[model samples]
Target: MNYEEARAYLDSRVSYEKRGMPESTELRLDRMVTLLEAIGSPHADFPIIHVAGTKGKGTTSTMIASMLTGTGRKVALHTSPHFERVEERAVISGEPIPGDRFTRLVEEIASVVEEIDAKLAPDQPGLTFFEITIALAMLYFSREQVDAAVVEVGMGGRLDSTNVVIPVVSVITSISFDHTNRLGNTLAAIAREKAGIIKTGRPVVSGVVKEEPASVIREVCRHLHAPLREAGPDFVDQYHSKGLAGGRVEVSTWRRSWPPLDVALPGRHQGANIALAAATCDTLEELGWTLPTEQLKQGLRLCRVPGRIETIRRHPLVITDVAHNEASASALVAAIPSRPEIPPSSPSPPRVLIFGSSVDKDWRAMLAILLPHFSHAILARYVAHGRAVEPSTMVEDASRAGIPVLTAETPARAWEEALRLAGTTEEPQEPASSDLDVAPLPDEPMICITGSFFLVAEMRTMMPLAEASVRPISS
Candidate 1:
């Protein structure tokens, strides 16, 4: 009936994220379906928006919830992989579930969870950590009488516990190569798993652009007779600008067009994410939700996700982004100032990158995508439930990529070394340039710490004044 007890109960359950999905456990909806049925099917009490994809699901979900909440509706947003605390997974009206309330809910559900587990066979692991989390979110939203709930798939969609909900609109963000072992190897294969969220007669919005994956989604929509709205020609996001500060884009849907909107998240790819959220809202509009352009713009301007090109410091700039896979890694690199091709001609400040990755991730592809952009790289192991790829493996990857790298004992040490390397100015400086043609002295050398969410969370804890939860900064 307290935070510690709740945490201990959750920690004891089978966590697929911590211990990679096992062959012994079956991935199916039967358990969740039964569990919800036993608990009175709380998810059916309210309308839901189901989101699934390899990336951008969290951002898109947050944007939709923000807009709904801004319109004076009580919204529930459920996401995964909490950066600081477990309570982050279930938020109502832009606020985390209160500790006392969470404790009461945990106590309330313990009996049902025990009853279900007791009925399962000895060899079967019935309910997982993720499933319990989903149950808790649904129960809480139903109890609170929320107007709507935004549920993000914890992983690949088909068998994900959150799939138990029949959403009013299903949104699938960009699909890429991630969790290949669990999902599948080819894009088409991955798209098949992601498309499982589509339901008969439910409107589906897809942001997947790869030809193969797009084709798969189209076929699934056609077969299911789900109304499909693609992001390319049907919904458009025209890029305006992108930088560490933020990004700007003009999003257009069939219903309406908005002027250049400020996306608090950095990177041009976020333009696509914003467009996806817009399309989702437009779908809700058809479902009879009152969402005006002013409210939509307010929500877009107010939504900011931390650890995604998040700036923690200004002087001797220190940035932290969670770019674990190859696709996200490329986006992170594009956000940073790259080294000029002609060394001295259009010189950028010295770049130092501090990196770490999961043992199961595509290190070779990620390293090849990111290492060349930095002048110096520091590699280290991150502390997390899953093991980090060893520095030796990183060394080999960097060597094959023809880039020099320095190793550290831990992420904290890597941060320290990055600061030391970034501050060092050994090269003799050219005489202060009075010529206007010469770009005025570039800002101090940049330090970018990325590669894993654990690394960013750890680094944020070390920085002064860094809070566990982050929201958009009002300019």
Candidate 2:
């Protein structure tokens, strides 16, 4: 099969990412286990670091993989929701899987998938897109003889396809109210699903500091006899400063204390993720891996996750981030340069917010947090996926948030609208009161494209030199 054919084969299966999870579909790891058994149990060939969380798991996973690679180890990093290409989900030593290799792997797995489909029980669901992808990644990593694989859970940890592997260390980042319908609504309930990755006698690195979630992780660890390394108490990250370039943070663990280091990813929230990655590396060292301090520092300085506060353009300062929910939106708002507080009497509009989100997300709450940071918002639907919340549905939310809103048919059109708005500026008028806080605006206005990964992906395609960029994929 060629690349296109492989894509078609994968797309034909049931994908919860494209279509919202159906109540009729029962999520279980049995199907994944059966498939792996039929394929010679490739997941057992290497050590794994399983990561699950609501927000920062992907970043944390990438950081771990990059650091390991910096130590001259061949590491396999598997993440979900590709932005541009499907191969982005599987990375070996900082490079995406080649198209030809991906196609051949899909062809190899096709027959096994059919064989399993034929023997399934009547009520059992067939292999899903996520399950197949995980199997393929495992098979490829085994074939390549990777030293370690960092697998980021696609969803909740208990039944996620990636959960089949026995990881050396399980990492759970912060937990919040994302996917509340599937994973329980409360923090404790959600923490239960995330803590499912903690195995018997294995060590766990948890970034959850909230009492409700942290307590859940602690109980699970205690019951399983697993070592627990809580973020606030065991390891900590202190934020130094943030800029358009990146943020500086100082990380401290039981093993050592590191000076303030520049994190490639933006946002002060990444301070926690960096600390988690550092602590995980410390655990790996305890597990008999040689990771030098300099190499770890190099990995942290050079690592980049494309869509997380990525600046695609210089003029007008177009930034794209996948901040789909309330916590992420709040972080994005805080990470970006502080907006000049416009007085009520000012006529010119402030910075532009180009946004979209999925139907399952708490978009109303997200808007409440995001709208206050921008004077105008251009709403659009991402065409790559079917779960986008309608632009019209959010009109009232924007109005209630006291921000003027405009709707576009698609993400591309939204970009057009944003550029048009950013290009025009009214003469600067003196404030009615001298007491008002007024920060000077740059010569080029700023535009932020965010909300959903699909929206960010679509906007990314419109950026200059986009094809030559890192070519990000999503979950």
Looking at model 1, which ten-residue stretch has the lowest summed lDDT? 431-440
lDDT of 1 by residue, 1-475 (tens): 6789998898889988777675524887888887788778999999999999998888888888887777777889999877777788888877778888788888887889999999888978858888888888888899999999999998889878888889999999989999898889999999999999999989999999889999999999999999999988689998765555577888889888877788657778888988998888888889888887776777777776778877655445667888888899888888665554444665556678888888778878887888788778888877766567777677876776555689986877887787677775232132211221122236557678888877777777777522312653221
Best by TM-score: 2
What does candidate 2 score in Cα RMSD to the true structure? 5.4
Across 1-475, the per-residue lDDT of candidate 2 in tens digits comes to 8889999999999999999876625887889999999899999999999999999888899888887787778889999888788898889888888999999999999999999999999887679998998899899999999999999999888878888889999999989999889888899999998888999999999999899999999999999999989898889988865465677889999888986777657789999999999999999889898889887777667677878887655446667899988899999998887765566676554478998999999988888888888868998999977899899998988888677799998976887788788874332222321211122254447788889988998877766532212432111
Show the colliding residue pairs in model 2.
Answer: 81-474, 81-475, 82-473, 82-474, 83-473, 83-474
Task: Tell me how far the alpha carbon of residue 303 in candidate 2 is from the true structure, in angstroms, after superposition.
Answer: 0.2
Q: How many Å off is the CA of 393 in candidate 2?
A: 0.7
TM-score for candidate 2, residues paired by index: 0.93
Backbone clash count for every predicted candidate, in the order shown: 0, 6
Off by over 4 Å in 1: 340-348, 424-441, 465-469, 472-475
After TM-score superposition, the amount by which residue 77's alpha carbon in candidate 2 deviates from its true location, in angstroms, is 0.4
